[model samples]
Target: MNTMVWKVDKYVDNLENNPQVVDAANFLRKNEVVALPTETVYGLGGNAESDEAVAKIYVAKGRPGDNPLIIHIAEREQLKQFAAEVPALAETLMDAFWPGPLTIIFKRKEGVLSEKATAGLATVAVRMPDHPVALALLKSCGLPIAAPSANSSGKPSPTKAEHVLDDLNGKIAGVLDGGVTGVGVESTVVDCTEMIPVILRPGGVTKEQLEAVVGEVREDAALTDEAAQPKAPGMKYRHYAPNAPLFMVSGTAGFLQRLVEEKRSEGLRVGLLTTEENVSGYDADLVLACGRRGELETVAAALYDTLRRFNQENVDIIFSEIFPNTGVGHAIMNRLQKAAGNKLISE
Candidate 1:
């Protein structure tokens, strides 16, 4: 497909249906893939009902067949068509946070959605995106779209339209550019099947936020269980990796700095992933300030792009300050651990 991108000026609410949206919607109706912005990240989308259409998304991103896709709907009423049962917590959570970055896993009715969308699982992950362009396109398409992050599998997920174009150009039919997404990460995926709900993947929605709404939500063991088949899109992959090997630097500041210096002295071009508080403190060949030290959201938003930038700078190795393993920090560390391929250095 000859990929084309159309930029929407803003994600304003209640705007007239424009020509670009019509064109993109037409492409989707034809069982073609298009990249559209959500509140979280750009998603490469196809008609969820068509097995053949959903299969193309896997080919476009080189994504594994077993990794399921999230079904996006423009309205809540559509869930009745596929959802066999909606848990009370799911209803409460959806009432509070639908049309945002939270994906609720529903036990699906057989033959409602493409098997490829759910990976033959009885449950289907669904989210209603909170972006004007995405909402408008979903409404215009009049179909539930199955989508995953618009980038190569195991690479950094695209947060901007340009990022989508960079990774998915010519592979998709078109891109509906809606500028930078608000939440830089993907949706927090919650499994509603169990008595105690579990988070399959953490992203824009924190565990604290989910527990506040539903009470006693827990992180799934599936996230860390390598032996188990992945229940979510990013669970079983070496995702968000840059070209160079990355390491998570643990222990004191002095120890990390000394280690980086030692590597640089060996004729290696070292890179430092620091924070705003210590941006001027690093002495590596290249240093990138991710975000303010205490601001987990800022760091989460910039994490992937920074890793991608390291490649552009041609750094041989990267060492990052250890992030707090709480709130959005957990999601950041999750991606970092995978990106670094679990190579963590501690004093």
Candidate 2:
């Protein structure tokens, strides 16, 4: 099928008042897929209550049916229509961080939301996006939108409209351009349906931030080799990867340097993504200096763009430094490891 790409101007200041957004929302109401920008990332959106619209999202991205999508709403009031029961803890957390980068899972109301949107699961992940374009689209449509990152399954999530066009250009109906996403990562997903809050995915909102709201939040168990099914989006798959082979560098700086040298000495064109300080003394064909060692937020923001750049350069192999395990770093490293696919531990 030939995809239709709409190049809407970036909605920067007043999204709620944008006429282009109203048109995008109307398009979604008609059971069509629209790529809309969000604070976390761009999402391929469809009406959550419409099975036909939700199915279009799955087909557009080639996403697996078992991997559920996140639903975006304009306000907290919309939650009542979808959730069967909203816990007290969820309410407290919502008061503190609603209209932001946090998604809460709750028991779904039978007839209110389409089961296809949740991949036949009884639970639904929902959030109120902070981006002006997202909120504007939701408000104008007057319905909850089920969406996932605007890219093909197992590929890098799109932070800019161009990335969406690259992956979904001919696959979707239209794209409402908002400038680059500020958070530049997916939303933090917490399962409030459980007795103790379980974090299904770490993203724009950190574990520390969730802990402060819910008092005690635990990370979901790692996917077992035997049971590799993903409970949420971006889990249980080799996602956010570029075309070239990627490696996550671990251990000392010397070890990374040696690995790069070894790969280069083998006559392979290597690409290195590391801090500005680590860029020196590397003989790699392409080197992308991200930022300071501890400043992982920068790396998180630049990850996909850097990978896309390497792919454009036609590098044989890509070596990315492992980010420190904290805040957004955890999520960044998670994606890096998955992109690497096979692990190669250097002695």
Candidate 3:
């Protein structure tokens, strides 16, 4: 399959009618998988109602069949077409964070969305992406789009059009390039089936932000307990990982440097993943800064891109500095921990 790249201006006022976006939407309507940009990351989207379209998404990303895909909708009213019922809490959250990076899991209305998209589960994960290009594509296609991060399974999620092409070029139908993503991570997934909502995954929307709107929100045990099964998309598998083995260091910079030197002494091409403030503090084969630690949002935004850079440099191994698990720091730490495969080294 020849994968086409359609570059659309994200700033266009009438993006829904843009030729490039319309062309991508046309592909999607024909059950052809296309990658579209969102505020969080580029998504490998397909017709949520078509089995064939959903199957192509799994093949393109080599994603596990058991791991469900999130459904992206353009309008709020579209939720009723598939969701059996939206709880009161979910409605409040929608009012607070719809068209943003927050996915809510709700009980499904059978025979609406493809069973494959929901991994044969009774509930479905849905989100209204904030990006103009994403909304335009969703509206143009007029289908509940089942989408996951447009990257190969267990690899870093694509935050830019180029990143999508890096992993999925020639593999999918085409890419609706809308430049770089803002949030730079996936959406925060919350299961609202029960009275007390539980956070399945942390991403662009922080737990603190969610709780502020909905009051008492609980986090899934799987977020910390590795043995527990995760209820959200992209959480069941190792994700945002680089080609090289990444070990997260939860100690002082000096201790991290010592570990880097120890690896270098063994004739290894070591890489250090740190912030701009600590860039000069490390002397390794390659020391890349993933934004400033003081501002955790920057760190979260640059995390995936930095990991992809290490792959390009062909580093033998990586040692990443850990961040605080508060506010947006929670999300940054989550992705880093997953990327490192829970490989943590203490002082």
By lDDT, the best candidate is 3
TM-score of 1: 0.96
Model 2 Cα lDDT, one tens digit per residue, 1-347: 45445445554666655778777878898999999988888999999999999999999999888888899999888888989999998898889888899999999988888788998888989999887678878988898999999998888888888888888887888988877887777888989997888888778888888887678888777532315445665576788887878888777777877888898899998898887777785668898886567677877777777777787899998887777778888777777777788454654
Clashing pairs in 2: 3-170
Q: Look at candidate 2 and tell me the lDDT of residue 138.
A: 90
Which stretch of 10 consecutive residues in model 2 shows the poorest summed lDDT?
222-231
Question: Model 3 over residues 183-250: C-alpha lDDT tens digits?
Answer: 88789999999999999888888888988898899999999898887767558778889999999998
Error of 1 at 93 (Å): 0.8
- Clash pairs detected, candidate 1: none
lDDT of 2 at 271: 91
- Predicted candidate 3, C-alpha RMSD: 0.9
Prediction 3 TM-score vs. true: 0.98
Task: Give per-model TM-scores.
Answer: 0.96, 0.93, 0.98
Leading candidate by TM-score:
3
Ranking by lDDT: 3, 1, 2
lDDT of 1 by residue, 100-188 (tens): 99999989999889999999988999999998889899998999999999999988888888888778898999999888877778889
